[model samples]
Target: MSVGSENLPQFALVGGKGTGKSSLLESLVGKDFLPRGATRAPLVLNLRKSDCQEQGIFLHRPGEKIHDFSRIREEIANRTVILAGLVRLSLDCQPDNFVEQTKSTIMEYISKEETIILAVTAEGLVMSQALEQAMMVDPEGARTIGVITKLDRAQDIAMAELDNKVVPLKWGHVGVVLRSEAVKCWKY
Candidate 1:
């Protein structure tokens, strides 16, 4: 599926730490129309000198503190970018005073930005409570895209179950499955 122009789609890579959000980011950058040898080993957005002229990939590593979002906010305000490895701060407590603060933090980061893509951890979605918190980060419907990573682990999750999650993927969006388990249908 293709991304629509009308929508300022925010792509989120939602999964655990090892779910390969970083690897996927590399893949996307590699696929971009970068000038030869412009891509660097460690992930960094060298937009002007970037080999990929078509797409701009920026990653915001906001340390555990929500206050660290200033750096990310600065980048959004400065230019057009596609953020990867973008994660939401996951908290367990009923932050009495911090809830609004957290939402405000996210809104501030998202406000007036031309585009923002989020990479999330699936662990946040496995339960109702976590899902609610996630909803705060990504509302019920916000043109936000989700990708569940780390299927390689999570024993209870079968390949079939994993397939179900992807089938519901919004058109033009991708729900990437990490590994392909051999299916028995072909030979029989």
Candidate 2:
């Protein structure tokens, strides 16, 4: 299908800082391509096939200044799910209004029939007010889903949050436990 005519499913990864958004992306794509640390602009990851090629695009916000990385394209693939155009938001210690831009950006994509996945860790429950509001904007949960990262770190709390509706994810919550970084060496 041609790029202009085809409407691919877009997913936005909304979360607070140090919540393992990049790590999840790297694991899903099977590569460490996304830049670590503060993410200045939202990115659109275009996944076409699973051959380990580099294919991605850095989306620019409306009326925002353009930069060298504003527009990018690469080809890559991996096992499991291959989702592109993953929008990411860094909501650490920033003003509430700052998230407006992110909400608008995601809303634009949702209006175009895209999906948004809110990524958050178990410890992030205390810091989920912003995310809760973000999800409430699409309260029916038609366009948003919640992902709980770092399950190993807070399994009990994660369960309680999801069960008690503390976070109240309309689409429900998915728990993920990443392997320990120290156990990298293979024993077999």
Question: What is each predicted model's overall lDDT from 0 to 1?
Answer: 0.36, 0.51
TM-score of each: 0.38, 0.57
| Model 1, C-alpha of 117: deviation from truth (Å) | 4.4
Error of 1 at 165 (Å): 7.4
| Model 2 misplacement above 4 A | 1-6, 50-54, 60-103, 110-112, 124-127, 162-171, 179-188
Q: What tens-digit string does per-residue lDDT give for candidate 1 at 14-40?
A: 334355554455455443222222121
Residue pairs whose backbone atoms clash in candidate 2? 45-84, 45-85, 53-75, 53-76, 54-74, 54-75, 55-74, 55-75, 56-74
Model 1, stretches more than 4 Å misplaced?
1-16, 31-107, 110-119, 122-124, 128-134, 155-188
| Model 1: residue 30 alpha-carbon error in angstroms | 1.9
RMSD of each: 11.5, 9.4
